[model samples]
Target: MDEVSPEETPSQKVPPWLFRAILTGAVALGGLYVLGWLIAELKMLIVIVLVSFFLSFALEPAVNRMERLGIRRGVGTGIMFLALLAAVGLFLWAIGTVLADQIGDFADDAPGYINDIEDWLEDTFDIEVDAQGLLDEFQEGGAVANLATRLADNLINLGATVLQVLFQILTIALFTFYLVAEGPKLRRNICSLLPAERQRQVLSIWNLAIDKTGGYIYSRLILAVISFLVHWLVFWLVGAPFPVPMAMWVGLISQFVPVIGTYIAGALPVIIGLLDQPSTGLAMLIAIVVYQQVENYLLQPKVTAHTMEIHVTVAFGSVIVGSLLLGAVGAVLALPAAATIQAFLASYLERHEVVQELEDAEAAQHPEREPLGDRLRQMLDRVFTPK
Candidate 1:
């Protein structure tokens, strides 16, 4: 073979367009890789913004009400924030008191309860349950196990969670404050970026989104409270243990996770009742079943309809799809996403007369060319004709 210099090869002398095309492809691929990372971070930022937006919306009515009574916006906002903080503190204190009482009760009766449970299961179901085996499996070490092992573990976890919650709360508060303060300016700036023809559409979309989000949050809060109170009263009536605390937990957690709330809410009380009293557990189960029917047929329709205007099928499908995508987070977000899509569709239908006209023109042009109908009509005409 002949020796080839570095620049003498035919392959080395690439066409300008070919070289540019390869360079472009490489640049595009690099840009896309960076974009994916940016999108993930952006999603986190959007979630934070949504949290703040909802908090501000929830507090807006209070702030506006305060302003109506002659308070300045700053003062109103501050007062509303303080009121929220105070309410949260009071709620936490109440929860702590109830939890402590429940814990003490459980601790005092745990051994007796365990013995009773073992005896009951053996007698009722002919099955032997080993309480010690469970305890032994859970017990893993010395100093960690010595200082009230479960309590220490719980406290450590709670402390970590509290710190995280505090950080989130601070982030939410800062975001909410700025959102409330600069909301109008932000809206204006966003609108200013669009062309004049699109400005209206943008504003409409923005308003619709805000309305839907705020409405969803408020409606959910109301529903959660209603569910909590109903479950608490029912559980108390049915002689379930820790009715208030368990009911509160069920209500809050269920509301946080959509579509499965009723089932999840029913589970804890039923389990506790089973452990405490089987007959009472059965009664509680029946009560929960009945209440879920009432809620599904009556309360959900009335509450969610006012907020979202989505069909029941759409709502259920959205929840399922959401759960499938992001687990619990997806389920929680699904209703809003559905509502947003519905709103977008409605807006498109309302604004796009040209689209409707085009569709109509196309339909008229095609006119369902029915050869059978034409032939049938012609035969009828021939038969009826007098010659």
Candidate 2:
């Protein structure tokens, strides 16, 4: 107001250091943006590489044992792969036979199953849901029909892109083969790049990962076998058709796939039950649920903990985190990755025992006015008990 002095605008008179800082930040941000774009572009390749690494780690133990018995690594890997392929081929044939024989029966009986469900709903919930109308709509262009159409379209699109998918698979297999063949040499070369102490640490982590991956496969196989036997017995007692194949399917799928695997395995038997007789379906459902409870509370924690050496909370959390980060692929790889990190940290971190204070222990043991820790302990005991 008082004859405003010749003033420089803020930008025109910016501090030299401030300007330099802004320029540096802009450059860093630009570099980060470029890096992010590159990663997004190559994400599929990244997934393939990770899958190959996981396979190599998982198969390393089998390859090593083969080597110990005087077989070459390359030949051993081939043998293991052939055995796996043959097993898979046999399973597929079993599934095909089951489907071919049973699908027509299921189709023929679907209406009866729907009528039973409709009657049950009316009796129990007093709700009027039109089973036939719904089925007609579903057949004639309802949401289900639309979904089926879209799925068919997607399958066609997938077929168009099959070559690329096959190429990616081939690339992964080749990389895994090479990795297993030269694992020791590769480890030595990598370790040579570090200090002796760091080298030991790296090798220790590598060995731990291999052991854990192999252990994980072994544990899953054991569980799968248990699942197969239990399911086979239940199906046979209930007079379900194709008991062997259905049980085998449940076992393999429930073990290999996470989260929804049990439900998926259970659904087939239930569907067959409904097709045959409504009561049978209900019984099968009850059995599946009961067995699942037993496995969750008794078998799973013991077996998985023994192999993984991780807490139940950690195992569950890792699966969720991995599912979030990498879709299905992440879920499959998360356990081994988490086990490796946990083992590595254990190597370096200090160990300590946590003893409860005497007073706290006394308070925890009190019948009434239970502490939160005591309540939690009780809950855990219930969740983990054999009963």
Which candidate should be chosen as best, given TM-score against the real structure? 2
lDDT by residue (tens digit), candidate 1, 128-241: 999987777667645446768789899999999999888877888999987666666777998888898899987787667667766777777777788789888988988887
> What's each prediction's TM-score?
0.68, 0.77
> What TM-score, to 2 decimals, does candidate 1 have?
0.68
Q: Give per-residue CA lDDT, model 2, range 1-387, as digits (tens).
A: 588678788878858799899999999999999999999999998899999989898888999999999999989989877887798898999989978778776688788889999999999999998988887877776778689899999999999799788898789889998889989999999998999999988888889989888888888888999988998899889887788988898888887787778889888878877777898888778888987877766677668877876765776788899999788999888888888888878878999865669657867887457645456558879999988
Per candidate, the number of residue pairs that clash is 0, 0
Q: What is the lDDT of residue 23 in candidate 2?
A: 90
**For model 2, what is the C-alpha lDDT against the true structure?**
0.85
